[model samples]
Target: MTKFLKTSLGLVAATSLLFSCNEFKVTQETDGSKFQIHEKGDGKTTAKEGDIVTFDLVIKAPNDTVFTDTYKRKEPIVMPVQKGAFKGSFDNALTHLSAGDSATVYVSADSLFMRVQQPLPPGVTKGSDMKFIVKIKSIQTMAEFQKAQEEKKNNEAKVMENYAQKNFPNATKTQYGMYRVVLKEGSGATITAGKSVKVDYTGKLINGTTFDSSVGREPIEFSVGQGAVIPGWEQALMMMKKGEKSIFFIPSNLAYGEQGSGPIPPFSPLIFEMEVIDVK
Candidate 1:
């Protein structure tokens, strides 16, 4: 189910048994859990709670319908292990795996959908098995993963700084840390909190890829300072006057932060070219 894509519990993998690449093996434990290992690792490595693991996972239902696949999403699932957060046999199978290991853990479709509070689809029944093919890529302590994450954020910030300096030489940073460049000044009323305003705008990422726009459609109207938009738009719009045109370089903290919205990846900086069409 698509709900699995947005859940923290779905990131966990359960541990089970061992098998060889040359032969297919299926084992059903006394507890009614089943698993099949396609390829075994060297067995020198293992993971536990609080450790971070990176892996590619694909969930398949009957008829070869894929529920979700991290490989096709272009982003492998990297997450901290939190046991008992989810109610399923899948994660129990992960404890037996190490880096370079791959396996298919099976769970009853009824158990999974019931845990997520969803009804099973037509092709799946109560006792039907939902298969998860998981390939463990890497494992690290939480401290190591945190350090890597911080380094990644710093690198992205540096890239944004270089781009802003090279392309917007005259841009001024605001007191709240937003970089701004006014293109056209207006003599109309100043925009303020609680004021209703209408604007046409184009939004892009740091790479100049446009993600959204109001230019070809109707201008959007919203009340200022009402949390009606992203923090970037709310802050930048307050600095503009009616009919003013400006370009803003918003950091991730003021845009989407680490948990990005649709089409926007985590820790992404954004660009916006906007015109304040009216203030009411």
Candidate 2:
């Protein structure tokens, strides 16, 4: 989101002073912009405009409260450099940093708030100086990133296939790669496209972490062949009949694909224990 982009530029300010410490030299620019270099890094290449920079960050407010910390997630945040639009002193700082560089920068919250329309936290005053401790995890051009992502996805698919063979060898797979195991046969009405089906379901990631369920809540009803649910769910519901129960192992592509929903990561396989309560 743009909030990430704006927060990335919190180090931008217009003017300069210099200070030195045993570990690193700090260059203080006008309006509370401070850049400290910890390691220049051994990588020959530096991040350029349009390149995606992946970094770990921790942002804290003046009240000593944490605002955002990607380190806690154990995943680095990736942001593309857009030079012409939101170009700032931080972008310039990135050009000097290479992969593996670790540094700290300080910027005036007042100056940052002026550039972007954001409400300050209750404890943060107008002129509070925000601190950013960042470590450059990696840098990649858009093309390179895309290629890596494709390779990763293909590897995940292979793992998913192996998992299915081991856990549900008797299950049948659809053309789109969703594997299904029918637990109970239904003698009631058959499900079809354009019919409304009510279902009780529990969904989880391949790692056994439950993401959602309708165990306590009432069963949900939605029309089939509509974009109301994920493609895998829609497809599986169409093959089921009233009172039928089944388990579906959905590949990432048929489920959430590259863009996962809330609490889900990109390219994650899913498991759904489903029951068709009624069909109309």
Candidate 3:
């Protein structure tokens, strides 16, 4: 299952039905899960196994409580359609959708928890149903998805390159695509893998929006090469000596990639002003 779907599962609880069963034609899956098409799409392309699907989702709990709503987030869930993870899984429900189609899927709460190997949340019981309201946004083949991703990456790279040229004219481009400018040199051994270091930093996007900082707070400590931070930070810190201050222009691939972290948009380039305070 995709991240959004997993989040929905964790939030699942017993919920009242939004519609009567007689109102819509329900089709049952091989594993006894069911779905009803609320609106048919005009597109002729139907999703199939191995294709990538983008869809908005809404999971509702009892008393009209929304467990999750992709529409509010403004990003739809995208995943490759595959064989159902279990009988009556969303994988089967997805096969019945086409671009622009809207449907409601009913899945067993108990089966969902069992498949994920997690205990049910409060208010959910052994045989309760979970409701998924989905709107199929698009479907693309694997090749198509890869091509689109490549295009996005290339576009972001160009934007970052321009930003670096204008802002840090003398920045050195690392082999992995990060741009670095040494603001202050320190005399001591440079940081290396397995070394623990404490650093104060302010992180921002390419457009100069500060997302995080450690100026007033105590410096964060982490071990080099321990995967404690983003790849960009790991690489940048390794090149610095204790007390050195540097500015780094990190590309999305080294920062958050396509799945951006909180307050960072996907494919965003990041800027960091960092000072290594201690090394051990």
Predicted structure with the largest lDDT when compared to the true one: 3
Tens-digit per-residue lDDT, 71-190, candidate 1: 766557877766643445676566666888888888778888888899998677777889989999988898987787677577876877788899998999788667899999966667
In TM-score terms, candidate 2 sits at 0.68
TM-score of each: 0.65, 0.68, 0.62
Candidate 3 is scored at a TM of 0.62
How far off is residue 80 in model 3, in Å? 1.5
**Where does the lowest 10-residue lDDT sum fall in candidate 1?**
13-22
Q: Write the per-residue lDDT of candidate 2 for residues 1-280, one digit (tens) a residue.
A: 8997776565342111222344487766542237677776667768888898888877766676877787775556777865422323455556556899887766567766666778876777986766677799889999998887788688886877898899889899888788899999876666878998899999988778788899999998899988899888988987889889999998888888887675566788899999998888
lDDT of 3 by residue, 1-280 (tens): 6999877766563222334444467888665658988888875888889999989899864334678898776557888999887778877888877898999888788888889898977666678777899999889999998888778788987888888899999999999889999999977888899999999999997767778999999999989999999999999998899999999999998999987876676788899999999999
lDDT of each: 0.80, 0.77, 0.85
Those runs of model 3 whose alpha carbons end farther than 4 Å from true positions after fitting are 1-42, 56-58, 63-76, 85-87, 100-103, 117-119, 135-137, 152-159, 163-176, 181-195, 200-219, 225-231, 239-247, 252-277
Cα RMSDs, all models: 11.9, 11.4, 11.9
